[model samples]
Target: KKVEEQNFLIRKRVLEYDDVMNQQREIVYEYRDRILEGDDMSGTAREQLGNVVDRIAKDYLEDDFPENWDLHGLYNQLEQMYPIGIDLEELDIESVNRETLIHDLREDIVEAYGDREEELGSELMRALERFILLQIVDERWREHLQNMDYLREGIHLRGFAQIDPLVAYKNDGFEMFTELMNSIWEEFARFIYVVEVETEDHNGAGPTQPAWGSSSNTSSTAAFSYAGGTAADQPSALAAARAGGVPEEIQGAADYAYDEVEAPAHVETRVVDDKERVGRNDPCWCGSGKKFKKCHGA
Candidate 1:
């Protein structure tokens, strides 16, 4: 009975050790890969991805000290150790005291290259890798958004599908996200071909970021300015009326035959004592040289 019990315990230990070993191998591969070719990632996202990795590792390794794993905290440390963008006021990778963050991660990979700490190591590696991928993806996305000035103003793509603008943006944001992920992978592959080791914050903190800049890479853009614009061709009222107008349609011209009426021929004709007055009796000086009774006065 005692011999059988001992054998059962040994078998259980062996299985546990095997699980640990498999996890450690995964951690090593992932860590080394990121150290060689990782880009940059944000803090919050790193924490979240780290949690995912931790959960996956726990499922496989089934460790007893699950509570000891705080990947979010570890990621914060990493960010403080290796920030991204430059700011005159902010600390940069160039000003850091450590050699390289990748070095530290590599050392961690070497030291933890076993099943015993496989779960924790896996979390660390995943967290680091995801952060790197995230940066590339984010840079690409920001560039896309900034370039698409139309989208910056916004689009009602959903409205084309008979949906609301907000709904459309939300729906298309997923498509955008998928494309961003693809861009990240493609960029990662490209970077891996020639990228080399570089210094980052030894404190493991990510960098303070910068504001998004607009890109001039777009093919079509309507550069807008509020300052007095280029003058546009505008039509005069007469031209507009001649082309298409309410008054033109409402009032047609009158063709009155005014051959005998005096008032109709001229307005306010002078009746002063002049040497040659425009007399009606004197052959009607309106050039209708007829007798006064037969002409305008009559």
Candidate 2:
């Protein structure tokens, strides 16, 4: 009888753990179904864009005084996400407050988005939005499920800390789910602004291309160059965005194209003295727009 009771307890514990994932699965599936139904996601996209901008603002504009704000950092950060037209260097700093900064950023992003929609037309743009959103949600949810399995395997260890293992698992799971949803929004917003549709037949003779492809040697790093970028393209900001920061899904998206370039054989090599070497915290010598520690130093 005692052995049978122990078996029952084990099964009950397993069911309780699975219930957490069950709730999450329901939420994710319902979201996926809505997308599959071909709902107009422009409003959702705008809301997410606002959220991304507000998140950046909160990070760099939290201070009240203009002197206390990091406008350069803010500009660099924004470059990683969208190709906004606002020139921070051109802004009148003394007249600018947090509200002014937010308004300008939002206005530029909205304008850029409008231009993209006009270029692509409403039907095509809507189709692209739905396709991208659904792809991201499905991929992220699959990854989340794997993560939940890993979490469940170790959650029982919390009992050693004199805590209820099941309670700890539930709390941590909730936090992870929240992060997953936020990441979906961030990635979708970033991709929409930069991705472009291209075809193999530039002369318009062959059938339109169904997708884009990228290839690089294992030793070479991949970088995405937006097709419609303006004079605001910052090589430094692009380097920072590509510096091990982007999600794999974005890096390997269907619309992205990259190339591998080998260094010239005739170039001379120079060894710098230790004192002249870039500090780990200093800017990288490669002009990748990231600190040495985060770039080559890493």
Candidate 3:
């Protein structure tokens, strides 16, 4: 009974951790549903592009004085991210303010995206966007789950520092989740701008495949068994005496213990000759009040 209670508590604790992952899974799935429903994603993509441009601008142009900026580095970053075709040396740095630079970069990016749409066609571009976004979200979410598992396993060690383990786990999990969200946005945007669509021989169309797989049948069972000796399987005292005490095999069987048993209401009692066999859930013959499942029967 105590073993059963402990197992129940352990399962409850596992569910608590699962709840966090379940919530994250729902958010990602909702995004996937929107894509599948053919919702417009250009607005979202534009917002993400703005964020990327802002981050790069901050890195290269970190001073009020235009002369202090690294125009070459800024150009390299923009070229790597978008298909902007402008020479840094051709521009007058003093005349090109930050607003002008941002506006020009945004125009180039928008044109690059428009070119891709023209090449792939609107329908194909929508499908590609959905595929890329879903793939990035799934891959990053899987990595995040692995990281959270590692964090949970080691979090209890924080107790040594006089901290509550649960509190530490919650805080670290939240930070990891935030990082995961950022990674999804960055990876999704990068793939969107850079993905190459391969043309197929079939009608000059791009290679296409189903985004998800078909379902399959599955089955499960609850019963469990282990190799070991039960109390009823033990040799009788007279039989043991005749065999020069318990045999090595019988003695070794003592180490194997049953970890669970049915309740008394579900068990049947019987007697054969002068000896009675004990139910697996009954109290042990060794005089311990604990259930046989956790004591000698164990």
Cα error of candidate 2 at position 145, Å: 1.6
Best by TM-score: 2
Query: Which tens-of-lDDT digit does each residue in 1-298 have in candidate 1?
Result: 9999999988985574345335434543453344334323223333433333333334432333333343344445433322312221233434333223333443432232232124333333333234334445446655655533344245545567777654454445546545554454444323221222222342476642111112232211111111110111111222222333233223333212233443454557767754256464577655666865577667
Query: Candidate 3, after superposition: displacement of residue 72 in Å?
Result: 2.6
Q: 38 in model 2: Cα distance from truth in Å?
A: 1.2
What local lDDT score does residue 97 receive in model 2, on the 0 to 100 scale?
Answer: 80
RMSD of 2: 23.3
Alpha-carbon deviation at 254 in model 1, angstroms: 84
The local distance difference test score of each candidate is 0.38, 0.70, 0.63
Could you tell me which residue pairs clash in candidate 2? none
Question: Which sections of candidate 2 miss by over 4 Å?
Answer: 1-9, 199-298
Distance (Å) between predicted and true CA of 290, model 1?
89
Superposed model 1: Cα runs more than 4 Å off: 1-138, 147-149, 152-154, 157-161, 196-298
Q: Which 10 consecutive positions of candidate 3 have the poorest summed lDDT?
A: 217-226
Candidate 2 on 183-217: residue-level lDDT in tens?
88877766776666553543677543223222231
**Candidate 1 TM-score versus the reference:** 0.22
What tens digits encode model 3's per-residue C-alpha lDDT throughout 1-298?
9999999999987887777778777877777667655566777776777666666777787866789888889888777666676687578888878767876766666677787778766655665565566556767778888998899889889999999877788788888887787777665555556555553333456443212111121111111111212112322212213433344566566434322233244567865742147677888777879877788767
